[model samples]
Target: MYVAVKGGERAIDNAHAWLAEERRGAPDVVELSVEQIREQLAIAVNRVMAEGSLYDPDLAALAIKQARGDMIEAVFLMRAYRTTLPRFGTTFPVDTGQMRCVRRVSATFKDLPGGQILGPTFDYTHRLLDFKLAAEGDVTLAPEATEAAPEVPHVTEFLNSEGLIEEECRTDAEPPDLTREPLETPASRALRLQTLTRGDEGFLLSMAYSTQRGYGRNHAFVGELRIGVVSVEMDIPELGFSIAIGEIELTECETVNQFKGSKTEPPQFTRGYGLVFGQSERKSISMALVDRALRWKELGEDDSGAPAQDEEFVLYHADNVQATGFLEHIKLPHYVDFQSELELVRKLRREVAAKDEVT
Candidate 1:
């Protein structure tokens, strides 16, 4: 045991040095800059920001670089770094209706008020790889549009105007912060949304997919999905008014679900909303679906006993940082614990042998 403890400090230092060398890779190859990661690998950066619960692209990029492109590890690093920063003030809820949208679409409508701006989507792209991108070469600039895109209205608005969709109940109460407060079972919709926003994309996607495969079918249709930049504003006590702090890119998805009418209410469409940091359409869509499934109880529907509908299960396991930490810690030193287990097994075997001889 003493020998096992000896030189542990030196070994750890050497291991760290080796890790740094590995992270750098071959000396002949040019190292990737944080800026390059920020711009080119923007999706990965966005995912890290969303899961990390931090909005700094630069820091997320640096964390990605340091983590050697391991997204979960990058998220861990970002979360660690974020905890050290001081909280100033909470921002006012953003008005996404006024977003300067780069991409907006509605599966429910072909020619909506927005005119269906295709934006920068790969929906029409051929999945075949282009050899030109293999080697760096000068690229032709994309043609510019003559005019700006028309303002897109929420697809749900049409349903609302027709009285076909349920009106959202609003409250004046402040939303609970999941980071500051411990997560409780049977969480409120606001707290659940907060947890889902910070949940692992893969986990949420799988949960969402399960619903589509009939685990807890809600008959969801994408009402509208938009990606754009929105200004974050904070009210200043001294000024007695709100001021724009910064702009952040966000993707919002609204799913219209088919709902059977209750005795008191007429049959109307219900909605699931998702708003996530950066342009993460897939995550946003998945979040919306999962959100809808979780709302079964509130909608006066019977629970299908789906995993997504289990509030405690979903909320408790959604955090990749917490899940990974518990999982990876087992790889650390467990010598004493293992030794005790081994001794117990040996003693059990000896007792069995003695019993057999006596019999």
Candidate 2:
């Protein structure tokens, strides 16, 4: 007996109701507030913002709570929310050279123009679990203010002064938005960088690591990694002037890579750039390395057939939302296809048996 089930709408409604209950949890347990998530689970919030391409910590936190702490789901929620937002105006490209950095470090030079500030990093901290954190939080005093330091220009600027690094031309061209249009082959540098910013951090890290392992080894040095807030300004056509719309936290990484000069050009250092939303230095640094690896052909370096060197491969697999959606959609019903295959196999066997007997 074939029982035709038809309750798609009802099922969806029930699922949503259940999800709402799950997100809320027990009444006595106190619901997780957006502010609490933003303040307490800052790292998770940072990851959400980085992948979401939205800098609002509050919205990221809310998405996180709604998604039951699933960072990728939170990122998806943010992306969906951002898509509905109407375009007010475009911001001029932020000059990272003018960034008032909270944390700035360079691995290339020991003593550069701007002294390295390690800032708040867990790199040196032991991996051991702290039982005290589970019981109670510790209060620490704020450091005394010191004299303001001079604005540090980019390290690449110094290299450019000596004709060592590749000089980037100042262009007034507007870059294409990846979200608004379908990505085509032979993407512009701007599009590539935009894709990399919201790309999966682990995937980018592994690709970058593969390059270091001689897959497409272009000797790379972290020229600079800076995390700070930058003002976003938009030009008002009616007013004939640019105004500060808002401020967003950003992490920018610039990598200096070795390049052999061609016949026409002199031997000089090339650069790879990564700029992402929020305090996501790891993602930004990984992005920078991958960016350089992908530019092997442009820099006159031979393609070593590395995954990072393949733009189609890298860009296609970077976004978690796209990857996850296609992956999870398989969970939906495919019984009809399975049953057809089953019937075909049975028919083939019956025919073969009948033919053998007739022979």
lDDT of 2 by residue, 1-359 (tens): 01244877777778899999988999898787899899988878988898887778999999999999988899999999999888876788887777777788888877887688776678788999988787867845449553323468888888888999988855677888987897776888888988999898888989889888988887899999988777788999999999988888778999998877886668889998888887788889899999998887776667788888999999999999999899988787778988999999999999999999999
Please name the candidate that would achieve the greatest TM-score relative to the true structure: 1
- Against the reference, the lDDT scores of all candidates come to 0.90, 0.85
Measured with C-alpha atoms, the lDDT of residue 112 in candidate 2 is 84
Q: Which stretches of candidate 2 lie over 4 Å from their true place?
A: 1-4, 145-150, 349-359
| CA-only RMSD, every prediction | 1.9, 2.8
Tens digits of lDDT, candidate 1, 16-45? 999999999999999999999999899999
Q: What TM-score should be assigned to candidate 2? A: 0.91
Give the local distance difference test score of model 1. 0.90
Whole-model lDDT, candidate 2?
0.85
Candidate 2: pairs in clash: none
